[model samples]
Target: MKRLFILIAVGLMSTAAFSQTKTDGVHIYNPEANAMADLKAATEKAAKANKHVLVQVGGNWCTWCIAFHQLVDTTVVLKQAINENYEYVLVNWDKDHHNDEAMKYLGFPNRFGYPVFVVLDGKGKVLHIENSSYLETDEPGANGKKKVGHDVKKISSFLKGWTVAAVNPETYKSK
Candidate 1:
């Protein structure tokens, strides 16, 4: 009986591990991508739009990264803000650690955590390395325990703060 129980536990653990590697559902992380070219394309798009490039670094294996992508997809205002101010790109950081050159160029921002953000100007200059954890809020749950999740308002503010319009010379000139 003990052996059977151990087998069952091992099977469950394996299932969980296998699930983590699967990208059958909605996932933004693509570990096999050529991130440098993607970033260049996004920068070009940003230049055309007169916006900045927001690079999201993480792998599909990260639950928080998935959650962040889902939040952006579902939240109307947040999506609009991103659409207006930035050309978004998702760069994969998997077990193989692909895109090392791109990550190195961006100063290795994955040191913060999964789902870290880096904003680049249209000219491809790094402007900010945003830690997504700072955009999350800890609220009390129904069970009276703290639960951390994305705060839409905080993310919107972050987007707005890093936008081209926000950094324009005219805005600074008045001050």
Candidate 2:
């Protein structure tokens, strides 16, 4: 019984550490960071990867924002798609409106609500402004409870739709 208790305690501690390990600014959603700087950095990275920049605008205060983050972090296919095709940037929309200036440049995505998204091409041009609500599903949970989170298939499709595939000039032969 004592050994079992020790094992359980170790498991809990490891799980706690795993979750909190991503609390750094780059991983956790920070409201105080310069959103424009982050956008610029993401744009550069996306350009190098030939991927789009996915800017998620939201605050840590919002439950749905947290839920969306968790969904993307844990879902393997969704996470893989995001990793392979986008540079993810989390822009905060706190009550103090820390990054309002950047939002102005981004066309005020906060108007949609927390956890809205902006997609930018490799060159940093605005491709789309996503209202996250449309990406979610209103289905019953296993316990017959209604839970709000992103639908993996929808997210995968959305990512694929926005992803810019590389072009091989060699393939364009003269007719």
Candidate 3:
């Protein structure tokens, strides 16, 4: 009787663990979310705030996508730059849900690869398509091997370059 109870308890614990989903910091993308609606809403908010829309195109399953998000979240400069200039949105694209309408609206930014970035004006016009690979840095890991991740300075520069003020005709006028 004791053995049977122990086995049942272990089995239940295993089942519970197996049924759990990945809910870490990396799981930023929701497969069920409406990408088009999210983009529209971000654009609307950006229009009102006089900012641009920064759309991150990737799935929750993508490690680089999560890493980039984590880096931006943890880094003060990057977070401030994004907050000051853009309304950020993550549009999930996975095998089960392609988010076709959103992809089309973004000019097929995913053609570059997963974790692509589409910078849009307040009016939803595509200003730039950034392949995330370009923002990555190859640094020596603890194992003495090259490990790649997004570079903070590069990302900050990118964000600054696309800001509304950066693109304004008046900003470029001779003082």
Cα lDDT of model 2 overall?
A: 0.82
Residue 70, candidate 2: C-alpha displacement in angstroms: 0.6
lDDT of 1 by residue, 140-161 (tens): 8888987667888889889999
TM-score against native, each model: 0.84, 0.75, 0.83
- Over the stretch 82-165, how does candidate 3's per-residue lDDT look in tens digits? 998999999999999999999999999999998999999999999999999989877788999877798888898899999999
Residue-wise C-alpha lDDT for candidate 2, range 37-152, written one tens digit per residue = 99999999999988899899888777778778888999999899889989999998877866977888788888889789888888888888889988887788998887567788
**For candidate 3, which ten residues in a row score worst on lDDT?**
20-29
User: Which sequence of candidate numbers ranks them by lDDT, best first?
Assistant: 3, 1, 2
| Model 2, residue 33: C-alpha shift (Å) | 0.8
Clashing pairs in 2: none
lDDT of each: 0.89, 0.82, 0.92
Measured over all alpha carbons after superposition, the RMSD of each candidate to the real structure, in angstroms, is 3.6, 8.9, 6.5
Which structure is stronger by TM-score: 1 or 3? Answer: 1
Of 1 and 2, the candidate ahead on TM-score is: 1
Between which residue pairs do clashes occur in model 3? none
